[model samples]
Target chain A: MKNRLRVLRAEREWSQQDLADRLGVSRQSVNAIETGKYDPSLPLAFKFADVFEMPIEEIFLRD
Target chain B: MTTGHAKRRYHLRMAVAMAIYIASLFVADWLIEDRGVTGIAAVMLASVPGLCVAAIFWILARLVIEESDEFLRLLYIRQIIIATGIALTGASVWGFLELYMLVPHIDAYWWPVIWCLGTGVGGIYNKLTMGTSGNCT
Candidate 1:
């Protein structure tokens, strides 16, 4: 999976740690997802969606 | 963060467990030297290391339970599975070598040592493949 998480976070002036704090996860997880090293679960994807206030499809894409 | 507390506690527990393990080793050595591995003394000495191993298991279980992040928990589970596979493979290879008279006999305690090393290998595996080490400590 590919995601615009890094771009979105950058646009929002949020660091990886900031997003991880908001999502109640470790900063490493945010970094992994952003770097495309690990894909988030559905629930976590939804949480990202909720955090970004964007549709899941907008943030994540099929690779 | 939520995980910060849990991570700190985990580290603290691991430190204490390691300290106890080292201390017990000294005690076991002293007992063995003084008592010549008599029945009760031998049992007591053996139990120290046994308890240390059990403590390690308890710590791993506690990590799984205390971790609130599902993704991190999943990573831990994957690492443990890999560690177990490595340990089992090592044991099987060593067993066959011993049976064939290709190697000297090994104590059972070495299995746990190998398993612990496997956990380190698992961490490296995760870092290579997952872009994160997924370290519990």
Candidate 2:
């Protein structure tokens, strides 16, 4: 899975820690997701969508 | 939730349990020496160390319960599964070796020690495969 999480976070001017705080996850989790080292579960995807205020499909792309 | 409070509680509880476990070892040794490992007193003395070991497990269970982060919880569960697999496999291999008279006898209590070491292996496995340590602390 590939995601535009870094881009989205950058647009919001949120650091990894900031995004992690919003997502209630560790900064390492955010980094892993952003770096394509990990993929979020469906629920976590929804959480990302909710945090970014965008459709999940818009943020995540199948790779 | 991986809060500071939870981490502190885990450390405190583990420290206490380990202290009790070490103390129970001494007590068990003293009892066996003095009482010759017979009677209800010996059995009860032996159970004290086992109960302290169980308390360590209880601490891990409590950590799992108190962690609210779903991803971290999943990681913890995975680590525990790996630890259990390693411990069981080691025990089975050792049992077979002992049965064939190829190895010396080992106490059953060592299984938990193997499991604890397996958790360290699991942590390394997570770091290698997951690209993160998955350390809740």
Q: Which numbered prediction scores highest in lDDT against the true structure?
A: 1
Please provide, for model 1 over B33-93, each residue's C-alpha lDDT reduced to its tens digit, 9 standing for 90 to 100.
7657778768888688778887887898888888888767777878888888998998999
Over all chains combined, what TM-score does candidate 2 have?
0.87
| Per-residue alpha-carbon lDDT of candidate 2 for residues B12-99, written as tens digits (9 for 90 to 100) | 9988888988998898998798758878888898888889978877887887888666556666667777888999999999999999
Clashing pairs in 1: none
lDDT of 2 by residue, A1-63 (tens): 989988898899999999999988878788878888778889989999999999999999989
Clashing pairs in 2: B1-B67, B1-B68
Indicate the docking level reached by candidate 1: medium
Measured against the true two-chain complex, the DockQ scores of the candidates, in the order shown, are 0.72, 0.47
Off by over 4 Å in 2: B1-3, B35-38
lDDT for model 2, please: 0.83
